[model samples]
Target: MKKLFTPFMLGSYRLTHRVVMPPLTRMRAGTDGVASPLAATYYSQRATEGGLIIAEASQISQQGQGYPHTPGIYTQNQIAGWKIVTEAVKSQGAIFFLQLWHVGRISHSSFQKDGALPVAPSAIQPAGNAFTSTGQRVSFETPRALELNEIQQIVDDYRRAAENAKQAGFHGIEIHAANGYLLQQFLEDKTNHRNDRYGGSIENRARLLFEVLDAVLEVWPNDRVGVRLSPFNDVGDISDSDPLELYTHVIKVLSARGIGYLHLIEPQVRSGLVEDMNHEAPPSVATLFRPHFSGPLIVSGGFDADTTEQALAAGTADLVAFGRAFIANPDLPKRLELGAPLNVPDKSTIYGGAERGYTDYPRIDEIGVNTSE
Candidate 1:
């Protein structure tokens, strides 16, 4: 636990602690996908000098959006909106990275342009429900297979979004290649059934990710960029027949590219394990891939102060990302250091809400408890 507070050099910046705030999507953006000023306050409240905060996933383009009010980086208004957020976080001496995202098949027609089918590596319908723009939960529709030309367009959009992120004053950028999004759809065998250059073998399946990385690199240096991958997440009904082989290749390539770090989500930490778990936790993907990756690794999934210290001490993870914990405790690092009582998060107001649950959580100093009670 003591080591978690020690400063370490990550790329060119020295992070004050290893506790990171991972991207947690709070759908409070406007209908036009512009970030609200509340987004600024939300991030600033949790800001720590020399810590890292990966902002919520922002769609690369209108076609890439899967939910309503999820911010986008493709427009001027969105960029201006993000400028406010980045400025607010930076003023507090925290570094913020924008997660570039595209929700490939985990979407419905209601969010699509002109009722066009959502695009993916194949025309398969994932087994899940998507929150439509109208706030209705509808079954995911079978996404249309992305044409080769369309794929190039999406890549271009990512490239442009990277530039926009830079203009918006972000310290770095994170490529969102996990969670069954567009990049993951192209990486996994079950979702990616295309026989084109972007499918088939592991190399081909991972082609889109590397291509997107290449585009992203045109604007930002390799060391100023990071990539997040979830090899064990099945949230979007995403599965890879050969996750090890696929991720190993992807990690090696990204390492060679000199990216700042690799963010991996551990399986034990997903949202629904308690109710559905039949046995002990599975092997951590971080431990499995640690030797394969030469860069910094940030692992996320239910982690306490003890587990986080253990992972850092064992050299399995460079940092620990806290999502749910950070939701209820804006001063998470401080609270962890003091071993103070934390505010339990309210699940109901996690998404698409106001300050009721977003920024209303009381900090330790503000918790007015009667010590004599």
Candidate 2:
């Protein structure tokens, strides 16, 4: 049996354990998409926690951004800023990967360039709104359909971003093809209603995603590159006529690319409702996707200690990523090892807040070094 705590050699990185901190979007960077000193402090504090650290989804271009303050990788200042984060994580002896992101239709005009409506594969608008810097919620604007020329530009943006990530002293990358983003929008039949080569059948629908991956890999080795996918997630009103066929083809194409890993955000919702009425034995994506994807798998979404151990024990996943747990407990691996009580995350400062909730989480030192004699 492969223990979750056992050491593993993934690509060129030697991880101390199998527990990976999945990419989590805190939206805490400053408005310029510059990495904050608080972010450096936050990751540095959690450095001793085992395995790899996949950094949050970073915008590849200004047009790729949907949120007010998420970090970007295109400009010089952004790369220099992210260097601080990579240096901090490396100092703690953990490998970090930059997650490249492009939020397609999940944006308001206020978040777009010159208040222009965001662009997507189709002219569809998502069912949600975005929070601006002023903390005001605005409905998502209808996205402009992408032209072939514009599509080429977007692909170039990802390539440039990948090269920038390498220059920023980061190890590897995970393309943001999950969570109803640009690549995901391109993959979904409903969101991508183009008649061009970029849409239609499964092969055409997946062209955009594969192209972006190829671009990123041009700057990064397959051993150092990973792609994140959420096949059946209905977020942003995304769906496909044949999810299994589309995903299997996508995975098969990716498998031969010699990519390092594939991280899948498991299906927790189906068509705006909790899956299978939120029943005892809900549908698991591992059953649907595990057979087709023939590479290292990292599964995320609502996994507990026993559940993660069971998945690894049964070979359901190569690694299990915990999102909220890593936020509240910087020493989450140590807590899980000792079965210690987890610090409940404070929802107040979860997004765009000061360092109170970001880097102020208590570690085992504060709890164990009690001098209450």
Candidate 3:
């Protein structure tokens, strides 16, 4: 457990610990893609030492947006707004990174320019509901297939977003290639059916993702940048013919680029092996890239304190990220250090639930018990 607080280099910045605040979609921004005051306060409270905080996914450009009030990095107003956030986090001894994102067909026409259907690799539509501008939940529309030349424009958007993020006072940027978004749309065979150089074979399917990474890397040195990949366990109607093979090929290619670290969201960790013997945990795509990647790896999704400590001890992953737990317990590291019980989060407030389930989650001390910070 003491090793979790040890300092290490995650690319260019020397992090005080391996505990990372993974990019969770906290839908608390203004319509113009600006961080709200609540968002600022929400992050400020969780600010602490030896932890690297990656802000929620923000759109690279207006066309990159899908969810309502998810924030953006394309405009001055947006950058200025995020500067308030990064500055606040840094002031309290926490380093912050902006997660650059593009939702692709995961968006609705009601959210696009002149109600245009969102653009994706092909005309395939994802099965999901998107939050509309009016805060209404709407279904996603089939996206327009992107032309070859048009792809370059999107790649350029990532580069410009990286530049904007740096100017916005963020310490670094994380390319949101995970969780069934634009990059995921292209990486998965079911979503990408193009026959051009950007499609077909693994290299072709991985072309756009690599190109976007190339564009962003042009602005951000490999050290100051990181990329997240979710190769298996499809959520958001995202799946490939062979997810493991596709991700290994992709990781083998991207890992060589020397980005900060490849964050892997792994299978659910068991609690006392559960009584259900028929049910087993799923496997992670990390095993495929384990031999391919040489940099530090951060693991996320469905992890508890014990599993996290165990993973680090077994060297399966260098870092562990807690999502729901982090949201409920601002003093997560401290609580874990003390082996204290955690505050169970109310599922209702997971998104757009206001302060009740958002920032109001009490620390261990708020319940009449105290833990040193």
Top model number, lDDT: 1
lDDT (C-alpha) at residue 206 in model 3: 89
- Compose the digit string of candidate 1's lDDT tens values, residues 196-302: 89989998998889999999999998888999998866657778777778888988888888899999987665542112221233578889888888889999988
lDDT of 3: 0.79
- Alpha-carbon shift of residue 179 in model 3 (angstroms): 1.2
252: Cα error in model 1, Å: 1.4
- Per residue, candidate 2 scores C-alpha lDDT tens digits across 193-241 of 9999998888999998888888887899898999998877777667777
Reference-based lDDT, each prediction: 0.87, 0.81, 0.79
Candidates 1 and 2 compared: the better one by lDDT is 1
lDDT of 1 at 74: 96
Please estimate how well model 1 matches the true structure, expressed as its whole-model Cα lDDT: 0.87
RMSD of 3: 3.8
TM-score of every candidate relative to the true structure: 0.96, 0.93, 0.92
